[model samples]
Target: MKNFKIVFTFVLFLLFSFSNAQKIGVVDTEYILNKLPQYKEAEARLNAQIDTWQSELQNLQAEYEKKRSAFENERVLLVGDQLKLREKEVMDLDKNIKTTTSLRFGANGEITKLRSNLVEPFQDEIYSAIRAVVDKNGLGIVLDKNKDNVISHLPRYDYTDKVLDILLKGSDKKEKTNSKGKK
Candidate 1:
C-alpha cells in the first residue's frame, strides 16, 4: 500500500508540472480588425468607390433600357432601308451595353487586381498588429479565435485582451504622430 501511494503521488506531480509549464493565448482576429479604426476607414473608402462604380453602371443601364423600349415601340412603323438602319443602331447599342456591363461587373483580372490592391495593405496592417501583440506579451502560442476549431471549450481568460489593448493604443499613437509630421 505504501509503494502504490508513492507511485500515484509521483504521477500526479508530473502531470501537474507538465500542464503548468505550457502558456497559450487566443486572439479574435476578426474582432480586432472590425474594431480597429484603420480597418474601418479602409473598408469605408473601398465601399464608396464601389458605390460610385455601381451608380455609373446604373445610369448606363437606364439609358440602354430607354433606347430599347423606344426601338421596340417604333418597330412596326419602320420601312425597308430605314428599318434595317434602325435595327443596326439597336444592335450596336445592345453591344455597347454588353461591353459596359462586362467592364463594370465581370469577375476578371482587373477586378481581382482592384480587390488585391484594396485588401492587401489592410491585411498587412492586421498581421503587423498581431505580431506586435505576440512579441510584447511573450506569448508562447497564440491561436486565432476565428480559426481555432477546438476552442469552443476554452475559458475566456485564455484570450489576450491585454495584448490587443497594447497593439491598438500603439497604432493610434503612431497614426497621430505621422499625421502631425505630415502637417
Candidate 2:
C-alpha cells in the first residue's frame, strides 16, 4: 500500500509540472519595422529631405568649382594690385564655400538625429505592445530575432505580423490625432 501511494504521488507531481511548464515565443523586429506603414512614411520623408539637401549642395559645389577654375585661369593674367584684389575675392569665395559645406553637413547630421527621434518612440511602443502580448499569453521567454542566434528550427518563427498588427492598431488611434493637427 505504501509503495502504491508513493507511486501515485510521483505521477501526480509529474502531471502538475508538465501542465505548468512555460510557453515561449520569438519576435522579429526588423520584419515588423519593414512592414509598418509609419516606418515607410518616415523613411520616404527622410529620403526626400536628403534628396533636396543633396541637390542644393551639388549646385553650391558646382558654383564653387566654377569660381575656383576662373580664379586659377585668371591668376597668371593679372598683375600687382589687380592680382591681389582677385586673390582676396577668391579667398572670400573659398571661405563662403567652406561655410556652406559645413552647414549642409550639419543638416545631414540633423537628419540622422531626426530619424533616431522618430523611430525611437515607435520602438518603445512596439516593445511595450510585445510585453503586453507576452504577459497576456503567459510567455516565459521572448527572444529577439535580431539578437538570438541559436534558434535551429521552430515550428513557427515569425511573430512579426502579429506584433505589427498590434502596433499599428495602437498607433492609428494616437497618430491620427497628431497627424490631423500637423496637416
- Candidate number achieving the greatest lDDT relative to the actual structure: 2
Clashes of 2: 0
Per-residue lDDT over 48-103 for candidate 1, one digit per residue giving the tens place of the 0 to 100 score: 87788778778877877887788789989988998888788778877877786677
lDDT of every predicted structure (CA atoms): 0.73, 0.79
The runs of at least 3 residues in candidate 1 whose Cα sits more than 4 Å from the true structure, single-residue gaps closed, are: 1-24, 109-112, 136-141, 147-160, 179-183
Give candidate 2 regions above 4 Å deviation. Answer: 1-24, 80-108, 147-157, 172-183
RMSD of each: 4.1, 5.0
Which TM-score value belongs to model 2? 0.68
Per-residue lDDT tens digits for candidate 2, residues 55-170, read 87788777778877887898899899988887887788778767766665565666668778878977897898888888777778778788765465484745556777788888
Q: State, as a TM-score between 0 and 1, how close model 1 is to the true structure.
A: 0.68
lDDT of 2: 0.79
